[model samples]
Target: EAGVAQSPRYKIIEKRQSVAFWCNPISGHATLYWYQQILGQGPKLLIQFQNNGVVDDSQLPKDRFSAERLKGVDSTLKIQPAKLEDSAVYLCASSLDPHPDRNTEAFFGQGTRLTVV
Candidate 1:
């Protein structure tokens, strides 16, 4: 597996600013996920995609966050008018299929650390 890949290892911006992170999942991975991990807490599911379509984004802050997997290969997550509370690590992961019955494995990138002041 080529493994999930992410860019911009770190970023720092003032409140109300904007930033975007990129992710490239492994080849042949049909399911991609984006997660947010705050300090001292477990990672939270923000969004997921099956191919180029969004499977679930209910947990994503729509007003301030947006994501897309245009070609079912790569994805991007953008946060506009960022807030201080948004400071956290944004992780990108990919899996073969997230079937409830199948125990699929996932690969994750190191993630991008964002600091909003």
Candidate 2:
């Protein structure tokens, strides 16, 4: 099966600017997630979608970060007025929602690396 896909594997932007990342999950998967992975830290859940409906986004910083998975297939994440502390890897993962805990075997893409100056 095709795996998750992300773009602009690397990016460099100045602080207070804006940047966006994209993701395409595997086919037939019903659950998608976005995570921010800072250097030396594990992936932190940012946003989660289940069939186009938001399941979890409590960890997302609404002040500067936003995301959408309109059709439950492809998704986009944007960071406006970026900060120096925002430099990190944005990882997208997808899984088939087949369990009660909503935890399926998620597949990760080669994340987008952002560098804020």
Candidate 3:
């Protein structure tokens, strides 16, 4: 199976600007997730989708961050008016099921590193 794919391995923008990132998951995978990883910190779940429906997005900054997985295959995340604190690595991951269990392990993409000045 193909691994997750992400575009623009790096991005730089000024505060209050807007940027977008894209992700493509493995074939036949029905679960996808977006996470933000700050330097020296673990990945924080931002949004999760199961077959095009959002399963969780409690940690996502709704005011500035938005995402969608329309066909349950690929997803996109956008940050509007990016803040200085938003500079971090955005990672996309996928698994066979949306729920976490002992059997499934999420595969991560290389990630897009965002830098806000």
Q: What 10-residue stretch in candidate 1 is worst by lDDT?
A: 97-106
RMSD in angstroms between candidate 3 and the native structure over all alpha carbons: 1.2
Global lDDT of each candidate: 0.95, 0.95, 0.93
Return the number of clashes found in candidate 1: 0
What does candidate 1 score on TM? 0.96
lDDT of 1 by residue, 77-111 (tens): 99998999999999999998888897679889999
Candidate 3 Cα outliers beyond 4 Å, as residue runs: 99-102
Worst 10 residues of 2 by lDDT: 95-104
lDDT of 3 by residue, 1-117 (tens): 678999989999999999999999999888899999999999999999988999899999999999999877989999998999999999999988745554568899999999999
The TM-scores of all predictions, comma-separated, are 0.96, 0.95, 0.95
> Residue 86 deviation, candidate 1, in Å?
0.3
lDDT of 3 at 86: 97
Model 2 regions more than 4 Å off: 101-103
Go through the candidates in order and give the clash count of each. 0, 0, 0
True-structure lDDT of candidate 1: 0.95
